[model samples]
Target: MLVRLVYASRASRELSPQDLQDILRRSRDHNPAEGITGLLWYNDGVFIQVLEGGRDPVNARYKRIVMDNRHDAPILLTYQEISERRYAGWSMGQVNLHRLNPGLLLKYGETQKLDPYRMSGAMLTALFDELVSSGAIECA
Candidate 1:
Protein backbone atom coordinates (compact mmCIF):
# COMPACT_ATOMS: atom_id res chain seq x y z
CA MET A 1 0.00 0.00 0.00
CA LEU A 2 1.15 3.53 -0.65
CA VAL A 3 1.37 5.52 2.54
CA ARG A 4 1.75 9.26 3.14
CA LEU A 5 2.95 11.08 6.21
CA VAL A 6 3.23 14.77 6.98
CA TYR A 7 5.43 15.69 9.89
CA ALA A 8 7.11 18.68 11.47
CA SER A 9 10.15 19.12 13.69
CA ARG A 10 11.97 21.90 15.40
CA ALA A 11 15.39 22.60 13.96
CA SER A 12 18.30 22.64 16.39
CA ARG A 13 19.36 25.94 14.88
CA GLU A 14 18.63 28.25 12.00
CA LEU A 15 19.45 26.40 8.81
CA SER A 16 22.69 27.48 7.21
CA PRO A 17 23.65 27.04 3.57
CA GLN A 18 25.90 24.16 4.57
CA ASP A 19 23.07 22.62 6.57
CA LEU A 20 20.83 22.79 3.54
CA GLN A 21 23.53 21.24 1.40
CA ASP A 22 23.98 18.39 3.84
CA ILE A 23 20.26 17.73 3.96
CA LEU A 24 20.08 17.71 0.20
CA ARG A 25 22.94 15.26 -0.02
CA ARG A 26 21.51 12.95 2.61
CA SER A 27 18.04 13.07 1.10
CA ARG A 28 19.37 12.23 -2.33
CA ASP A 29 21.25 9.27 -0.91
CA HIS A 30 18.39 8.00 1.23
CA ASN A 31 15.35 8.30 -1.05
CA PRO A 32 16.15 5.90 -3.86
CA ALA A 33 18.05 3.47 -1.66
CA GLU A 34 15.12 3.10 0.69
CA GLY A 35 12.34 3.50 -1.89
CA ILE A 36 11.27 6.66 -0.14
CA THR A 37 9.73 9.76 -1.69
CA GLY A 38 8.40 13.06 -0.39
CA LEU A 39 8.63 16.81 -0.10
CA LEU A 40 10.31 18.90 2.58
CA TRP A 41 9.40 22.44 3.53
CA TYR A 42 11.44 24.53 5.92
CA ASN A 43 9.91 27.53 7.58
CA ASP A 44 9.54 29.20 10.90
CA GLY A 45 12.17 27.17 12.73
CA VAL A 46 10.35 23.99 11.73
CA PHE A 47 10.93 21.34 9.14
CA ILE A 48 7.75 20.02 7.59
CA GLN A 49 7.99 17.00 5.34
CA VAL A 50 5.73 14.63 3.49
CA LEU A 51 6.99 11.11 2.91
CA GLU A 52 5.39 8.24 1.02
CA GLY A 53 6.37 4.66 0.35
CA GLY A 54 5.94 1.12 1.63
CA ARG A 55 5.01 0.96 5.27
CA ASP A 56 8.22 -0.56 6.52
CA PRO A 57 10.62 1.73 4.74
CA VAL A 58 8.69 4.82 5.60
CA ASN A 59 8.36 3.82 9.22
CA ALA A 60 12.02 2.99 9.47
CA ARG A 61 12.98 6.37 8.06
CA TYR A 62 10.66 8.09 10.44
CA LYS A 63 12.27 6.26 13.35
CA ARG A 64 15.69 7.38 12.29
CA ILE A 65 14.48 10.94 11.81
CA VAL A 66 13.12 10.96 15.33
CA MET A 67 16.52 10.06 16.67
CA ASP A 68 18.52 12.39 14.45
CA ASN A 69 20.17 15.21 16.34
CA ARG A 70 19.58 17.74 13.57
CA HIS A 71 15.99 17.96 14.65
CA ASP A 72 14.40 17.81 18.08
CA ALA A 73 11.32 15.75 18.89
CA PRO A 74 9.77 15.24 15.49
CA ILE A 75 6.02 15.53 15.52
CA LEU A 76 3.84 13.57 13.18
CA LEU A 77 1.42 16.17 12.02
CA THR A 78 -0.42 13.91 9.58
CA TYR A 79 -0.40 10.30 8.43
CA GLN A 80 -2.58 8.19 6.12
CA GLU A 81 -2.68 5.56 3.41
CA ILE A 82 -3.53 6.50 -0.13
CA SER A 83 -4.28 4.54 -3.25
CA GLU A 84 -2.34 6.93 -5.47
CA ARG A 85 1.13 8.42 -5.28
CA ARG A 86 1.16 12.18 -5.12
CA TYR A 87 4.86 12.43 -5.70
CA ALA A 88 5.91 9.35 -7.62
CA GLY A 89 8.95 10.42 -9.60
CA TRP A 90 10.80 12.19 -6.83
CA SER A 91 14.17 10.63 -5.97
CA MET A 92 15.38 12.11 -2.69
CA GLY A 93 12.36 14.31 -3.09
CA GLN A 94 11.99 18.07 -3.24
CA VAL A 95 13.01 20.64 -0.67
CA ASN A 96 11.41 24.05 -0.37
CA LEU A 97 12.25 26.69 2.20
CA HIS A 98 9.82 29.39 3.21
CA ARG A 99 10.00 32.29 5.55
CA LEU A 100 7.84 31.26 8.50
CA ASN A 101 5.14 33.57 9.59
CA PRO A 102 2.14 32.55 11.63
CA GLY A 103 -0.04 35.18 10.06
CA LEU A 104 0.78 34.01 6.58
CA LEU A 105 -0.02 30.42 7.50
CA LEU A 106 -3.19 31.46 9.25
CA LYS A 107 -4.43 32.83 5.97
CA TYR A 108 -4.89 29.24 5.03
CA GLY A 109 -7.38 28.62 7.79
CA GLU A 110 -5.42 28.07 10.95
CA THR A 111 -2.98 25.66 9.42
CA GLN A 112 -0.33 26.24 12.03
CA LYS A 113 -2.85 25.64 14.76
CA LEU A 114 -4.74 22.67 13.37
CA ASP A 115 -3.82 19.02 13.49
CA PRO A 116 -2.34 17.78 10.24
CA TYR A 117 -4.34 14.56 10.16
CA ARG A 118 -7.47 16.57 10.26
CA MET A 119 -6.62 18.23 6.94
CA SER A 120 -7.97 16.98 3.68
CA GLY A 121 -5.86 16.59 0.57
CA ALA A 122 -7.37 19.77 -0.79
CA MET A 123 -6.28 21.63 2.27
CA LEU A 124 -2.85 20.17 2.04
CA THR A 125 -2.70 21.10 -1.60
CA ALA A 126 -3.71 24.62 -0.80
CA LEU A 127 -0.93 24.92 1.70
CA PHE A 128 1.48 23.40 -0.77
CA ASP A 129 0.43 25.92 -3.39
CA GLU A 130 0.97 28.76 -0.99
CA LEU A 131 4.39 27.48 -0.18
CA VAL A 132 5.28 27.11 -3.80
CA SER A 133 4.05 30.55 -4.68
CA SER A 134 6.03 31.98 -1.82
CA GLY A 135 9.14 30.24 -3.15
CA ALA A 136 9.33 27.86 -0.25
CA ILE A 137 9.59 24.79 -2.48
CA GLU A 138 10.52 23.87 -5.98
CA CYS A 139 8.84 21.03 -7.84
CA ALA A 140 10.94 18.06 -8.80
Candidate 2:
Protein backbone atom coordinates (compact mmCIF):
# COMPACT_ATOMS: atom_id res chain seq x y z
CA MET A 1 0.00 0.00 0.00
CA LEU A 2 1.07 3.54 -0.66
CA VAL A 3 1.73 5.84 2.26
CA ARG A 4 1.84 9.61 2.58
CA LEU A 5 3.85 11.58 5.08
CA VAL A 6 3.76 15.31 5.65
CA TYR A 7 6.01 17.40 7.83
CA ALA A 8 7.32 20.90 8.36
CA SER A 9 10.75 22.20 9.26
CA ARG A 10 12.61 25.43 9.87
CA ALA A 11 15.77 26.08 7.96
CA SER A 12 18.87 26.34 10.09
CA ARG A 13 19.71 29.51 8.24
CA GLU A 14 18.48 31.51 5.30
CA LEU A 15 19.02 29.55 2.11
CA SER A 16 20.29 31.01 -1.12
CA PRO A 17 18.59 30.29 -4.42
CA GLN A 18 21.39 27.87 -5.24
CA ASP A 19 20.78 25.98 -2.04
CA LEU A 20 17.12 25.54 -2.87
CA GLN A 21 18.00 24.44 -6.37
CA ASP A 22 20.37 21.81 -5.08
CA ILE A 23 17.72 20.44 -2.76
CA LEU A 24 15.16 20.24 -5.57
CA ARG A 25 17.69 18.62 -7.89
CA ARG A 26 18.44 15.97 -5.34
CA SER A 27 14.77 15.37 -4.62
CA ARG A 28 13.90 14.99 -8.32
CA ASP A 29 16.82 12.67 -8.86
CA HIS A 30 16.16 10.39 -5.93
CA ASN A 31 12.38 10.26 -5.55
CA PRO A 32 11.59 8.57 -8.83
CA ALA A 33 13.79 5.55 -8.16
CA GLU A 34 12.00 5.04 -4.87
CA GLY A 35 8.50 5.58 -6.22
CA ILE A 36 8.06 8.69 -4.11
CA THR A 37 6.01 11.62 -5.35
CA GLY A 38 5.06 14.74 -3.43
CA LEU A 39 5.23 18.50 -3.00
CA LEU A 40 7.60 20.87 -1.18
CA TRP A 41 7.06 24.49 -0.26
CA TYR A 42 9.66 26.74 1.30
CA ASN A 43 9.21 30.29 2.46
CA ASP A 44 9.84 32.43 5.51
CA GLY A 45 12.46 29.95 6.68
CA VAL A 46 9.93 27.11 6.83
CA PHE A 47 9.61 24.01 4.68
CA ILE A 48 6.47 21.98 4.15
CA GLN A 49 7.01 18.65 2.44
CA VAL A 50 4.90 15.59 1.60
CA LEU A 51 6.31 12.24 0.58
CA GLU A 52 4.35 9.29 -0.86
CA GLY A 53 5.61 5.79 -1.60
CA GLY A 54 5.98 2.41 0.03
CA ARG A 55 5.49 2.72 3.77
CA ASP A 56 8.99 1.58 4.66
CA PRO A 57 10.94 3.70 2.19
CA VAL A 58 8.88 6.75 2.88
CA ASN A 59 9.45 6.33 6.56
CA ALA A 60 13.11 5.80 5.94
CA ARG A 61 13.33 9.01 3.96
CA TYR A 62 11.64 10.89 6.77
CA LYS A 63 14.18 9.51 9.16
CA ARG A 64 17.02 10.87 7.03
CA ILE A 65 15.28 14.20 6.87
CA VAL A 66 15.10 14.36 10.63
CA MET A 67 18.85 14.03 10.80
CA ASP A 68 19.57 16.55 8.08
CA ASN A 69 21.30 19.62 9.47
CA ARG A 70 20.00 22.08 6.94
CA HIS A 71 16.74 22.21 8.85
CA ASP A 72 15.68 22.23 12.48
CA ALA A 73 12.74 20.96 14.51
CA PRO A 74 11.07 18.70 11.99
CA ILE A 75 7.49 18.15 13.09
CA LEU A 76 5.31 15.55 11.47
CA LEU A 77 1.93 16.91 10.54
CA THR A 78 0.41 13.77 8.99
CA TYR A 79 0.91 10.20 7.87
CA GLN A 80 -1.46 7.61 6.45
CA GLU A 81 -2.17 4.89 3.90
CA ILE A 82 -3.53 6.27 0.68
CA SER A 83 -5.70 4.82 -2.07
CA GLU A 84 -4.04 7.03 -4.68
CA ARG A 85 -1.31 9.63 -4.92
CA ARG A 86 -2.31 13.27 -4.67
CA TYR A 87 0.90 14.10 -6.50
CA ALA A 88 1.52 11.51 -9.19
CA GLY A 89 3.25 13.25 -12.01
CA TRP A 90 6.00 15.16 -10.28
CA SER A 91 8.58 13.55 -8.12
CA MET A 92 8.83 16.81 -6.21
CA GLY A 93 6.50 19.67 -6.99
CA GLN A 94 7.50 23.08 -5.59
CA VAL A 95 5.20 25.73 -4.18
CA ASN A 96 5.79 29.45 -3.99
CA LEU A 97 4.11 30.99 -0.96
CA HIS A 98 6.34 33.98 -0.28
CA ARG A 99 3.39 36.28 -0.92
CA LEU A 100 0.61 34.40 0.82
CA ASN A 101 -3.13 34.90 0.47
CA PRO A 102 -4.89 35.31 3.79
CA GLY A 103 -8.30 34.05 2.68
CA LEU A 104 -6.87 30.83 1.32
CA LEU A 105 -4.51 30.46 4.23
CA LEU A 106 -7.36 30.68 6.73
CA LYS A 107 -9.16 27.86 4.96
CA TYR A 108 -6.31 25.53 5.91
CA GLY A 109 -5.52 26.42 9.49
CA GLU A 110 -3.04 29.00 8.37
CA THR A 111 -2.84 32.73 8.91
CA GLN A 112 -1.55 35.32 6.46
CA LYS A 113 1.85 33.84 7.17
CA LEU A 114 3.19 30.38 6.26
CA ASP A 115 3.71 28.31 9.33
CA PRO A 116 3.15 24.58 8.85
CA TYR A 117 4.38 23.70 12.32
CA ARG A 118 1.29 25.29 13.84
CA MET A 119 -1.24 23.45 11.69
CA SER A 120 -3.15 20.25 12.31
CA GLY A 121 -2.61 17.20 10.11
CA ALA A 122 -6.00 17.49 8.40
CA MET A 123 -5.46 21.15 7.74
CA LEU A 124 -2.05 20.50 6.26
CA THR A 125 -3.57 18.00 3.86
CA ALA A 126 -6.26 20.46 2.85
CA LEU A 127 -3.63 23.11 2.24
CA PHE A 128 -1.73 20.76 0.00
CA ASP A 129 -4.88 20.04 -1.95
CA GLU A 130 -5.36 23.75 -2.41
CA LEU A 131 -1.77 24.13 -3.57
CA VAL A 132 -2.36 21.50 -6.24
CA SER A 133 -5.68 22.81 -7.47
CA SER A 134 -4.57 26.41 -7.74
CA GLY A 135 -1.21 25.69 -9.37
CA ALA A 136 0.37 27.66 -6.57
CA ILE A 137 3.14 25.15 -6.97
CA GLU A 138 4.76 23.54 -9.99
CA CYS A 139 7.10 20.69 -10.82
CA ALA A 140 10.83 21.30 -10.76
Candidate 3:
Protein backbone atom coordinates (compact mmCIF):
# COMPACT_ATOMS: atom_id res chain seq x y z
CA MET A 1 0.00 0.00 0.00
CA LEU A 2 0.99 3.57 -0.58
CA VAL A 3 0.27 6.67 1.47
CA ARG A 4 0.20 10.23 0.19
CA LEU A 5 0.78 13.18 2.47
CA VAL A 6 0.40 16.78 1.42
CA TYR A 7 1.33 19.89 3.33
CA ALA A 8 1.92 23.58 2.79
CA SER A 9 4.54 25.64 4.56
CA ARG A 10 6.02 29.10 4.60
CA ALA A 11 9.72 29.55 4.22
CA SER A 12 11.47 30.72 7.35
CA ARG A 13 13.49 33.18 5.32
CA GLU A 14 13.96 34.30 1.77
CA LEU A 15 14.55 31.29 -0.42
CA SER A 16 16.84 31.04 -3.38
CA PRO A 17 16.67 28.58 -6.23
CA GLN A 18 19.90 27.07 -4.97
CA ASP A 19 18.22 26.34 -1.68
CA LEU A 20 15.36 24.62 -3.41
CA GLN A 21 17.77 22.70 -5.57
CA ASP A 22 19.69 21.51 -2.55
CA ILE A 23 16.50 20.32 -0.95
CA LEU A 24 15.53 18.43 -4.07
CA ARG A 25 18.99 16.99 -4.38
CA ARG A 26 18.93 15.64 -0.87
CA SER A 27 15.43 14.33 -1.40
CA ARG A 28 16.31 12.57 -4.61
CA ASP A 29 19.23 10.96 -2.90
CA HIS A 30 17.32 9.76 0.16
CA ASN A 31 13.81 9.18 -1.11
CA PRO A 32 14.71 6.43 -3.50
CA ALA A 33 16.35 4.59 -0.66
CA GLU A 34 13.05 4.68 1.19
CA GLY A 35 10.87 4.09 -1.85
CA ILE A 36 9.30 7.53 -1.77
CA THR A 37 8.02 9.60 -4.66
CA GLY A 38 6.31 12.98 -4.76
CA LEU A 39 6.03 16.50 -6.12
CA LEU A 40 7.15 19.82 -4.68
CA TRP A 41 5.70 23.12 -5.79
CA TYR A 42 7.19 26.38 -4.60
CA ASN A 43 5.64 29.79 -5.11
CA ASP A 44 6.22 33.10 -3.40
CA GLY A 45 7.96 31.76 -0.31
CA VAL A 46 5.37 29.03 0.12
CA PHE A 47 5.92 25.30 -0.39
CA ILE A 48 3.34 22.73 -1.21
CA GLN A 49 4.62 19.16 -1.30
CA VAL A 50 3.29 15.65 -1.51
CA LEU A 51 5.08 12.52 -0.32
CA GLU A 52 4.01 9.05 -1.24
CA GLY A 53 5.49 5.82 0.08
CA GLY A 54 5.05 3.26 2.78
CA ARG A 55 3.15 4.63 5.75
CA ASP A 56 6.16 4.50 8.05
CA PRO A 57 8.69 6.22 5.83
CA VAL A 58 6.27 8.81 4.56
CA ASN A 59 5.13 9.69 8.07
CA ALA A 60 8.70 9.90 9.26
CA ARG A 61 9.61 12.19 6.39
CA TYR A 62 6.65 14.45 6.99
CA LYS A 63 7.64 14.73 10.63
CA ARG A 64 11.13 15.72 9.64
CA ILE A 65 9.79 18.29 7.20
CA VAL A 66 7.62 19.88 9.87
CA MET A 67 10.67 20.32 12.05
CA ASP A 68 13.03 21.47 9.33
CA ASN A 69 14.23 25.02 9.96
CA ARG A 70 14.15 25.93 6.29
CA HIS A 71 10.39 26.24 6.53
CA ASP A 72 7.88 26.75 9.29
CA ALA A 73 4.22 26.60 10.12
CA PRO A 74 3.61 23.44 8.20
CA ILE A 75 -0.07 22.76 7.68
CA LEU A 76 -1.37 19.32 6.86
CA LEU A 77 -3.61 19.44 3.85
CA THR A 78 -4.14 15.79 3.01
CA TYR A 79 -3.19 12.27 4.07
CA GLN A 80 -4.60 9.10 2.72
CA GLU A 81 -3.77 5.58 1.62
CA ILE A 82 -3.77 4.70 -2.01
CA SER A 83 -3.58 1.47 -3.95
CA GLU A 84 -0.71 2.64 -6.13
CA ARG A 85 1.75 5.44 -6.60
CA ARG A 86 0.82 8.31 -8.90
CA TYR A 87 4.39 9.53 -9.15
CA ALA A 88 6.34 6.37 -9.48
CA GLY A 89 10.02 6.71 -10.38
CA TRP A 90 10.02 10.39 -9.53
CA SER A 91 11.78 10.59 -6.24
CA MET A 92 11.07 14.29 -6.25
CA GLY A 93 9.36 16.23 -9.00
CA GLN A 94 9.56 20.00 -8.89
CA VAL A 95 7.30 22.79 -9.98
CA ASN A 96 8.87 26.22 -9.67
CA LEU A 97 5.90 28.49 -9.97
CA HIS A 98 8.11 31.50 -10.37
CA ARG A 99 8.99 30.50 -13.90
CA LEU A 100 6.00 28.55 -15.03
CA ASN A 101 3.76 30.06 -17.68
CA PRO A 102 0.81 31.80 -16.03
CA GLY A 103 -1.49 30.38 -18.62
CA LEU A 104 -0.85 26.89 -17.26
CA LEU A 105 -1.98 27.80 -13.79
CA LEU A 106 -5.02 29.67 -15.05
CA LYS A 107 -6.31 26.39 -16.40
CA TYR A 108 -6.64 25.17 -12.83
CA GLY A 109 -8.79 28.00 -11.47
CA GLU A 110 -5.83 29.94 -10.27
CA THR A 111 -5.49 33.55 -11.29
CA GLN A 112 -2.40 34.77 -13.06
CA LYS A 113 -0.54 33.84 -9.92
CA LEU A 114 0.28 30.53 -8.30
CA ASP A 115 -1.07 30.98 -4.83
CA PRO A 116 -1.72 27.44 -3.68
CA TYR A 117 -2.35 28.27 -0.05
CA ARG A 118 -5.82 29.42 -0.89
CA MET A 119 -6.72 26.14 -2.54
CA SER A 120 -8.26 23.19 -0.77
CA GLY A 121 -6.23 19.99 -0.64
CA ALA A 122 -8.43 18.41 -3.28
CA MET A 123 -8.20 21.36 -5.56
CA LEU A 124 -4.49 21.61 -5.06
CA THR A 125 -3.97 17.95 -5.89
CA ALA A 126 -6.15 18.26 -8.93
CA LEU A 127 -4.08 21.16 -10.11
CA PHE A 128 -0.93 19.20 -9.56
CA ASP A 129 -2.26 16.30 -11.56
CA GLU A 130 -3.18 18.60 -14.38
CA LEU A 131 0.24 20.19 -14.39
CA VAL A 132 1.90 16.81 -14.52
CA SER A 133 -0.35 15.62 -17.31
CA SER A 134 0.33 18.75 -19.28
CA GLY A 135 4.11 18.34 -18.97
CA ALA A 136 4.46 21.83 -17.56
CA ILE A 137 6.25 20.46 -14.50
CA GLU A 138 9.04 17.92 -14.60
CA CYS A 139 11.11 15.90 -12.17
CA ALA A 140 14.83 15.57 -12.52
Kindly report the root-mean-square deviation of model 1 from the true structure over all alpha carbons. Answer: 4.1
Candidate 1 lDDT over 1-140, as tens digits, reads: 77887777888878887787688678867788878877776655667678889888899889888998888867776678888866666654454434545565576665565334455555665676565456555543
TM-score of model number 2 = 0.93
Is candidate 1 or 3 superior in TM-score? 3
List TM-score per model, in order: 0.74, 0.93, 0.90
As for model 2, its CA RMSD to the true structure in angstroms is 1.5
* Cand. 1 Cα-lDDT: 0.70
Tens-digit lDDT string for candidate 3 (28-137): 99999999999998878889998999999999999898889988888998899999988885899998454466776686655876666676777778878877886766
Instruction: Tell me the lDDT of model 1 at 26.
Output: 82
Candidate scoring better on TM-score of 1 and 2: 2
lDDT by residue (1-140, candidate 2, tens digit) is 89999999999999998999899999999999999999888887898899999998899999999999997999998999999998898899998664345678877664667578678878878877887787677775
User: What lDDT would candidate 3 get against the real structure?
Assistant: 0.84
What lDDT does the true structure give each of the candidates? 0.70, 0.86, 0.84
Q: What is the lDDT of residue 24 in candidate 1?
A: 69
